[model samples]
Target chain A: MEAAPPESAAPITPVLVAEHLERKLPGDPPVTLVTDIDLAIEPGKFTAIVGPSGCGKSSLLYLLGLIDRPTDGRLLLEGRDMMPLSGDERAQIRLRHFGFVFQFHFLLPEFTALDNVMMPIRRLGRLSLPGARERASDLLTSMGLGDKLHKPPDHLSGGERQRVAIARAMANNPLLVLGDEPTGNLDSTNSARVVELFRELAHEQGRAVVCVTHDPGIAEVADIRVSMLDGRICEVLRQT
Target chain B: MFPRLGLLLHIAAMHLLVRRRQTLVATSGVAVGVGFFLAVSALMVGSQTDFVKTLIAAAPHIIISDELRSPSPQPGVREYGKTGAVELHGYKVRNEVRGIKDWQQILREIDAMPGAIGSPSLSGAVTLRQGGRDEPLGVVGIDPTIETRVSTISEKLRAGRLIDLERVQGGVIIGEDLAERLGLGMGDIVAATSARGVSRSLRIVGLFKKGQSGLGSGTGYMLLREAQSLLGRPFVINRLGVKLPDPYTADAVAKQLEARHGYKAESWQERSADFLGLLLTRNVIMYTVVSAILLVASFGIYTAVSNSVTDKRRDIAIMRSMGFSQGDLQFVFVVEGMALAVAGVIAGWLFGFALMTVLGSLEFPIQGEVRHLPLDRSTRQYLIAAAASLFAGIFAAWLPARKTALVDPVDILRGAV
Candidate 1:
């Protein structure tokens, strides 16, 4: 895999948009996590969300992935309003359209790497067992994990586990992939390899990618950079 | 969305396999509960049915006697209108002789009713005197041929036969217990005095052993004519015993007979109502014990599954985030609980069968007969146990599962990471 900046014109329409989004914990003196947020995510690009600690970057990622609902404002996917959908409906949209990679890889310990990757695909129920197995195998092989298909998560290295998690997120061939500091636990060599993979996934694979990270290298290489502070985005920078 | 058995079992099997010991403990708890329930119910209900059977065979289902449930209304009250009636001052009720003079007609009417066999007999108190012993007895005068068909007396005779009551002059059949107590035997003659003042010399022709202790020592049987002569009430039979083919029809038949004839009629069921009520109470207590055992077993399942939910919180969150619906998650855990119950039920039925077999093999001597402890090894008890335990398992599993599935998974995933 090779990493290069896209030579194509950016699309005008965003695949997903959040308008004035806000989430608050309900209690005495309610604590607000994300507030008055507006953002657009486009296909075929890697958008890096960079913020300091305690800046609600992860909270915003949760809302964007529809893993968490905003207390206020609206979330839209493909120009369709998502605020009216039920929780199960949101889950269905997530299954069909979005994938997530957490900082810890979050692979089920009892399952083999292939089984872990095939979980979401199997739940989608659109494919037969052999078909799902083949799809999961192909995704893992593309991520250079073909030989470790049967290995449990505990037996794999941190980078390999993270790659397996990535393959799982992509098992359904989602339109967008989201990661929360996925390489935070990896060595520099592994981190650089993950960075190259994200770049190739955005450019060659023609998929939208978003990562919440403190890694400056990801910001330097991303197609767009979003900076946040105090639950609000303060700046947005684009690669001409 | 609810998952089918394939996915449900896949996850459930993995969870159970991972915690084999805990699952086994839960299953064993249910199995023990089920086993004991089957064994205890079989024994208790078996005894109840056996006791009723004994009662049905021991006496006539209905007895019509020369008695009144209530006194006849005063003649003065029956005669005049209330406004014109005068009360009698210092009046005394007349002493009336108690005998069923129309017993023959009543017996024929009863015998004509479908499935009823009526035996005309006299019941009176008599005192018997031997060389050095005297015993007070309740003597029942029966026509041997008809009485034997109505009662189990033929099977209870230890010496001679009921027909001997007719073969000998003034013949009497005493229970062996009474004869043994008096040191008397067949062919011995004894003087019997009536409750009034009449007396007669009677010869012993038969001896019966009840095999049960209650009435053996005080009961004697004789020919109807001999008892009437000894009791000084010749030509009058005081009781008409009606035996029914189906003992369960006793109550209705007794009621119908009493309404037709103005005599006090009593069914054996009514006579033994208190005992049958006690049996019903015993059954309630037995089932309560059964429920207690299974309730405690259900707690074990609840604890096992609850602990699993707490321990697998992260895994649950991951699966929830993977788009498994709440129903789907609940299905996995519920299946695990029911699987434990199913295993327990099978194992428990085997254990119970063995226990019943062991109990059924046990024999004890009562009076003169050796009898095995009664055990109702009916299939219904197994089915009841299975239904009860499975329901308990499902309930136990459902509570904790709902708690885990309905919670906001974001919180669990957040806590884990």
Candidate 2:
């Protein structure tokens, strides 16, 4: 898959916007982990967040993914205020519209590979069993893990498990996919392959991918790069 | 709805399957409690039913006694001061009721009484002579037509017809033992001699077998008129058999009649109170003991559910992340407990019934009691027990369920077990 930035004049509205977001770590004297971060991710655009280990990049990603609430700012998804939605409604939106990939894959250990991939899709609708099975199989097959349907996460390779996590994130056909150090635990070979998979998902499928990573090679492949230091964004580098 | 319910069932089934031994222990706790409860209750009610059956089979609901004359009065103001002077209170037995002069009139009046049923019976002792042999018999003069209303042995007629006590020349229904002793059978003639040297020749029309009692001492059944005739006491009956209208309230009616009419009366309850009392006492004691089993079973459920909540801490945390409310978590645990209880109840019911049947078939050790144990399921009692069990299961799971729901997802995700 080839990657090229869209024209600067593209008028697509931002799907996620974080304005002056702040989060504090609870302590005797509370420490500020994320402070006043202004960010926006538009539809059909790929962005990468890169910083050192203690830069709060993961916290920023979590806040952007709507899994963690900001201490002092509002989150807007599709320019609609997200603060008023009930917990169940928010979970439904996350399960239906947003996908997340964590460093460890976080696959439910007991379920099969296909079941892990199909969880969000199955949660979204009452599909017939065979229909759900077929969709899950197709997603895994496209990820190059077709024959591992019944295998548990423990039995799969580290890369294979992350691939399952990616297939799961994309299974609900979400508009935005967020990866928190998605290939942090993999070797260089597996890391490059996962980076290529993300590129194909973003450009060919026309979905936005915001990845949090410290790897410069993975960051170079993104069309837009936002770098963070301490708790705030230091620079935004856009490419065409 | 279908998909969610399917998921719920799938999850619950898998959880139970993976912990089969624990589930079995939980189920058996409830099952044993329920089984013992049902078995004991059934046997108690069975005995009660049996007692009623025995009384209905053996004798009438009411018995009229002879109008016993008071011996010379060593009297006072009749103790309660209801009478002003020293009054000789008449002791009435079966024979002396006002306007009940003849056997026919007594039968008519008894039949006409509200809620009253059955023809009258006259009882006396007589010796039946056959050729050179003689045997003393407890002779009863029966109204044949209404014998069933007065006694249970009416169902135990083995041969010939029940004697027509209304006949001028009444036939005798001898017990099998008496018949055997006298070497007499149906259609045979026997001569009966009374205490006062009064004699009558009677034809035996029926032979009865009552298993025990009213027979071993050579009892005889004859027409009421014939017994009165041979005794040279026309229009005189030594005893009267009364059948009340409602079998359930026989004792109350008998009491009312005794108080209102100044005649001696006896009910089936009054006749069999000793046996019925024994059954009631045993039932109360046994059921109280069985209920303790349910108490123990509830504790088992509490332990099982609490341990499950502990085991599924991470799962609960995931569920909370998926936006599960406290109520939702509560529902899951309560449903699990109730499922166990309901399963236990069904299993217990089956086992209890089977156990009762087995106990019923075997010769149980009731010492020398003649009554058999019975099982009965009253609707009220069954509902109370079921409600108690359901409440127990729910309450047992409540504490742990609440704690599980209140757990913060952040702590759980950070590797807290």
Candidate 3:
């Protein structure tokens, strides 16, 4: 694996781009979730999508994460059009190149933190059992969850569970880590800690971190902040 | 791919383990179903086997009779090689001796056939007269050495060997029931009158029991020469009994012989077709009724997996978001169903075998003979039962597993979180 790029290095090409992306749900009057959205996500950067509830922040995040298809637009992953790919091919892309952390910290309660982290690694089928265990342990340890590796989600605290979810998202060493309100259920201090970890994952480890949030404090730590209103991006601000 | 499938199986197993009570209930349901299926199969198949065995033991595989099934050409009317233009007026059928002419040549041909043992027999209706008590009976004349090869009666003799019939010229072997009814013992002289009204005094040298009262009380066996003299048919035999190594091939062999010899050769299978058909219908009904149990048990599996799928919707969405494909989600639940089915099948086989053993050990009277319950021991029955349960389990799991696989993560996540 390549080492994380330094923050001061020369600019690199964007790994993911969405051009005029749109999503609409059929209804008596069709409900447009996100429309006319254009965004480019670069490696070694933390980007925040901040919006109020019902403003389609999570919807846009899902589209970019490949969890949901765009209604009408082109999505490019590594400059290759992802719209033409089949569902299974898209799933393969997600499995290899992207990881997702949801707001509820949806760790499988039956499994311990270590086993939960090993899920993606095992699904990818690139690592041996022992290798997966070692990598999961290392990821958890880096997240300051070394002592809580054996605890199931039901036994872990809210903050510890969310951190475990984050460790799981990074299990396959994905190029893009997408989080939808990852700190929405966390306390202030825990949320701050999670925000700092997200920054380190982007700036130090050279992976792109895209997080949807309602907290202004989390947006303050991002290299770029995107604000959405009425299903459209109102502003894109470069913070640093 | 195997390792990935293994992971899916592990996940499935863990899901079942976490809900141990539900899993046990489902597994036990299938086990009970499979166990009953196997037990019923064993009983049904075993009874059929016993029935065929009893039938084979009672008669020869094929019986060729001297009487032609179709009428022969009338005398004075030339047929086949000659031109038949002369018709006789007031022609009547002659009363001739009821016996096979040229039977020695026929028997030679039959005995020459592969896997065939042919024995000439003289059978006629007779009256047993002992101290004015007259009882109607069927008498069979058998060559002791040859008849022993074609029929089981020689093995079933109780009082004397079949060779005694050959040693003593007028020796007779009567059934025990017949002997008791006549109040006659061995060495007692009994007068037998044939259908042609020829009377002869015979010494009862042996008593045999045929296991059924109908056959045992009405049949008698005697030497061939004595029977021919009593029946007033000299140097003639009416029936040829043939035994074959493979009784099921009797029909083909009988057909071949009948076609060649122009005699009515009846195979035991042809004679017992109705009984065999009854057995087949009984088997179909048995399997249909038994398979219903497995179907009911599969419903139990469906219910358990359906409940799990409904309860694990959020987990499914999360896994999907984490890049698990729809096939993976479906495989996990399918594996769960198969695991339960496999466990149940194993337990069922043991339970079924145990049940068969217990039943087989118990003895009861059947047709005046002590016999144990017949239980088939072939592995085919077990495999069929297992395969049935597995198929049912997988079918039951399919809908719910597919539902789990097709779940949209966005809809679930938007509503849930």
Worst 10 residues of 2 chain A by lDDT: A1-10
lDDT of 1 by residue, A1-240 (tens): 021125436335678888999999998999999899999888888999999997999899989988889999998888888899987788888888988888888898878999888888878877777888999999999999999999999999999999999999998888889988878889999999988989988889888999999999888999999999999999988874
In every candidate, how many clashes are there?
Answer: 0, 13, 0
Give the CAPRI class of candidate 2. Answer: incorrect
Worst 10 residues of 1 chain B by lDDT: B1-10
TM-score of structure candidate 3 = 0.95
Cα lDDT listed for each candidate: 0.86, 0.73, 0.87
lDDT of 2 by residue, B1-417 (tens): 455455445555555566677778887888787777777766666666765676676677777565423322222433535656544457343332332345455556667888677556566778888988988888776666667545656666677666443442557777877777778787788888888799878887877764665455467677767776766566666566777757777788777655654556777788778978987788778777867878898887787777777777776655544434445556667667777788777777777767867877665554344544565656554565577777777888786777775676555643442
Candidate 1 - CAPRI tier?
acceptable
Best by lDDT: 3
Candidate achieving the largest DockQ = 3
DockQ of each: 0.38, 0.17, 0.70
The candidate 2 chain B region of ten consecutive residues with least summed lDDT is B68-77
Candidate 1 Cα deviation (angstroms), residue B228: 2.7
